[model samples]
Target: MENRNPDRATESCLVLMLKSPGRSKQRLAASIGPLAAIAAEHLCYCAFEDMAAWPGPVCFAPADEHDGGWLAARISPADAVVPQRGRNLGERINHVNRTLRMRGFERQIFIGIDCPELDERYLEQAADALGDHDVVLGPALDGGVVLMGVRHEWPDLGELAWSSTRLMADLEQFCNALGWRMARLAPLADVDTFEDLDALKRVVGEDARPARRALGAWLANDGHRPETQP
Candidate 1:
């Protein structure tokens, strides 16, 4: 049987599955370099820490052995285990979900580290959605998802085709076929391309203090250039 936290098991848990800071996607180097990675890591850390203060358990679903130690040192030791199988994203996420289910977590919300705009309000909304639906999704502008929450252990890994433009559509169809009610939160943009970075500047504002400071510091010293193409 899964180990259930009497105080939090029934409440929703947030699972942040991430590649350790140093091992993030290298394609970002053309636009933001290590700063992009740093920003992503900071976003994940902040979300995890913020959600930890919620009325539920917050877990880190680190991607590898190296990440295990690094993440454990930064987050709670009682968090979920790292996934052990699959080279593909779909299989890996399914593995994590299965592991969490085995550990007696009834509801789970999983997210990536790419969206800095993701905050506590989104987390709360996801949890609330679980009260009426079997799944909740926060779709990204890139036709992928930034957040997914499930009320139970769902093994429909086929629904989520990782890194594809059809991912959201596939998931929606899969949920319909499974007779699972699905809910959606507002869509957010993921920072993956130069266009994405440009959009961020617009949304956050070019003159915004922290935004400007972060971009200036990154551009000044970080050896990164704007991508000519996505």
Candidate 2:
């Protein structure tokens, strides 16, 4: 993709932290059954579209090394496919952050496929926020962060409460202790449950991205059953 903001393009990069589509969104699976995998793929496609449109560099970090090929095939050929290494979320994020920083990307923004509303605009906002603040967080409505951007290497995040509602609070407190300047973006909902999907459908009406529109159609028509059963 062409760099929309050429001035900051070289220094900033977006890291997409992802798990295999077949293995993701287990919580949503409880409500949607096996269709969660299908939904996961759609969410992945949504992220791919956003990343392709991003002005700066974009990298994909797959939880498993075995999924590297799968991700590489989907992302832009120029985008790096870095496999994640860590027993937990915090460690994994720290590893990717450290790795990318060493690769000359001083400003790194991390996001997941769970938030379809995340787009190039949000990526640009996060990149811009990193210019003045030491850290930038895109607050998720469920008391978590949909996006996290940093201008410098992060402190030990291994102890932070990840994937919990206490995540946002814990992160803020951690940053405060280190005296890091923090900036937060507007809150957005991340899809995790059937209720979350329902709320999203009501908002993403016509003119939504193709992947998102297809997801909405599948949910409205076939309902829980995916177009093809796995």
Candidate 3:
């Protein structure tokens, strides 16, 4: 895709992707304690900082903006949207992408708030790839993706199947069917379960002070009464 606007380089697109901090997963934190909200806040902060200097505008879509307006202020001018009702994650993402494109952004990238390990270098690479590719993806070690970017008008948001373990593969197949060249960055892991938290601890070590503190506090008081399954 040719740079339709030279000034766009100074204005790369970004979306601070998030869902409401309290919901199904909210109860998990209750079991663990107050650290749940803190953990969620930290992840959002990490994601915001990671893509802070990208080439386009940064927008946020939270499930609710009551607390979001304040949180969004920490990042940039943000727009909140209820995650698409009656839809899966893929549909919601595609909806956000399409909304942004209609607003005149030449390129768009959506990132999840769960991946604190995500960094700017990877985002920069994705921006650079946008110069030639229709889509760029940062695949996660798990069966999902942490980031997705598009340089042109997005296709039908409903065309792609979402939230399955095959999400990444399904997206690739969609691009192939459309004859779009796709690019990928190195895979990274996202924090999801207790095991994921343990891995993050190992990777960051004592230096993982903040996340560790938050995780510890959460585990200490979370009252979910997590069950062990055989």
Task: Quickly count the clashes in candidate 3.
Answer: 13
How many clashes does each candidate structure show, in the order listed? Answer: 0, 0, 13
Using lDDT as the measure, the top candidate is 2
lDDT value for model 2 = 0.82
Residue 57 miss distance in model 1 (angstroms): 1.0
lDDT per residue (tens digit) for residues 1-230 in model 3: 22243453444577766764544135337554444555566565556565554555677766445545555556434433323322656666667777777777768777877676665566767777777788888887877788888887767656565554677887788888989989988888876655565466544433344543454444344322245211
- What is the per-residue lDDT of model 2 for residues 1-230, given as tens digits with 9 covering 90 to 100? 22245456446888899987888899999878877888888788888877777777888999996578678776667778777888889999999999988888889989999898876666777787777789989889999889998999988899988888889989999999999999888888998887887776665556368877877776666565544455
The better candidate by lDDT, 1 or 2, is 2
How much is 3 displaced in model 3, in angstroms? 17
* C-alpha lDDT of all candidate models, in order: 0.69, 0.82, 0.63
| Ten residues in sequence with the least summed lDDT for candidate 2 | 1-10
TM-score of each: 0.78, 0.91, 0.74
Candidate 1, residues 1-230, lDDT tens digits: the string is 12223343338878777877678755565556655566556445545655565678666777888877777787655655555456777777788888877778789988877775666666678788887789988899889888899988777484367887678888888888889999988889876775565555455443334434464344444223435214
